[model samples]
Target: MNAENDLIKLYSGRILSLAGDIPLTERLAEPQATVKKRSPLCGSTVTVDLVLEGGKIAAFGQDVKACALGQASAAILGAQVIGRTAEEITAARDQLKAMLTEDGPVPEAPFEGYEVLLPARGYKNRHASIMLALEATAEAMAQATG
Candidate 1:
């Protein structure tokens, strides 16, 4: 397919739906950890804040400024991060990276929403933007757990 067709396919209905209803748009109050990630390629940025409890996320929030791909990624992360442990988040991040960089399968449940981003794998320029949220979340989790 052509670039236009790729773009259209990449911005599928599921991606648009996720982008339209980004959860955790507000910053968390008194979070234990916070992190911000930016994609130099696309100027996409995502800031994440969270409070940890018993080695798992107790609360989470984010501010995302990016394209539909990035927004969808943040939406998926925001929707499922609340009760996940650092290991889980890290694994998801790794899986997402693999998917984007190596043609791996979508991450497991709760994170399966990342499937919507598979179409983005071919668009190298959009990779960093799509990864911003997960990278920021991983950093925030690390900061909290440290």
Candidate 2:
């Protein structure tokens, strides 16, 4: 399949799976720590909320007003991060950066879901939206730990 088509599928899949219009729409949450990131190029914004327990993520959620790519990225991040440790989330963020920037090998298992975003690598403008969730999540973890 073509890159655009693949992106469309990934975007639609996540947007369709998105639950509860209020949180994502109204941007409401009481996160342990919140990190907000914006794609200056496109004006897309993604704010992530992380609740940590025992050095692991007890919950992961986000409020995003952006393109389909950003929404899907957030969904994938939320799904993989819950129950994972801060270290694990950091590793995933690095892996995601590598995948998008260096053509690195895709991470295994849960992160494999992010493979759909690989095509986003070629679209430089879309990179910010694609990485927004991960960056914010990593920052939130850092704030929680420190």
Candidate 3:
């Protein structure tokens, strides 16, 4: 297949399937912290709300308005964020940034679903959108912990 076809298949297949795993499509009733991040490149946006208890995430919700990549990222985060400490979420965010910007390996287990987006490293335009979820999550966690 041509490069373009490969990119399309990568975006349309495993990356898109991850979107179906997102569970926090609605806003939380009473979150301790909330943060929204937008990608200037594609105008993709993600808003995350979270509650923390004993330094770990106790509840979470999100309003995602973005491309398949962004949605999939949010889905992966949503699936694994509960019970995670702020430090863990921050590490995942930093690791995701490295994976996208520095051609690093996918994040560790629990956040490893991001491996499906590895093809995205070659598509710079999609990076911001893909990072929105992790960025928003990190910000929300910070707000809760700060």
Candidate 4:
């Protein structure tokens, strides 16, 4: 699975990489729903924004200052959840947790872009960062749907 390259690509080519230097103010403007997540251990923070139209995400954005994994997760989360519904977002979030903890099934292909993050599961500190985006995403969806 060329874990190194996959992780590298996740960080380099993914949208999160572009956020490295964006001012916090600029990063906070995209979501119709938003939230701030923090990892007390590493002090990673991510603020996610989700804009929904007719129950589907019309736009997604975030302003984050955190580790590579956190930012990458946010980038992937923003991209993948764009057209999915709130219920789907919740299921995906649950799936992610299961996959990360090795307590349940992993996502199948096409959706398995998440496999790239598998390596992160072993790094305890990285776990929170990786999950931050999903937590924020779920929050956004709940707000949009309710």
Best by TM-score: 1
Please list the Cα RMSD from the true structure of every candidate, rounded to 1 decimal place: 1.0, 3.6, 1.3, 4.9
> In what order do the candidates fall by TM-score, top score first?
1, 3, 2, 4
Candidate 4 lDDT over residue span 17-104, tens digit each: 5344332234435457787889889999877777788888777777777787776666556556657777777777788788888755
Report the lDDT of model 4 for residue 119.
62
- lDDT order, best first, reads 1, 3, 2, 4
In model 1, the runs with Cα more than 4 Å from the true position are none
How would you encode candidate 3's per-residue C-alpha lDDT over 1-146 as one tens digit per residue?
69979678667766667776677787999999989899988899998988999999888899999988888988888889889997898889999999999988899879998988888888889889888988888888888878
Candidate 3 ranges with C-alpha deviation above 4 Å: none
lDDT of 4 at 117: 70
- Model 1: how far residue 114 lies from native, Å: 0.6
Q: Candidate 2 residues 50-77, lDDT tens each?
A: 7888998877667787777777777677
Candidate scoring better on TM-score of 1 and 3: 1
lDDT, candidate 3, at 141: 83
TM-score of each prediction: 0.96, 0.80, 0.94, 0.74
**What is candidate 4's CA lDDT for residue 118?**
72
Better of 1 and 2 by TM-score: 1
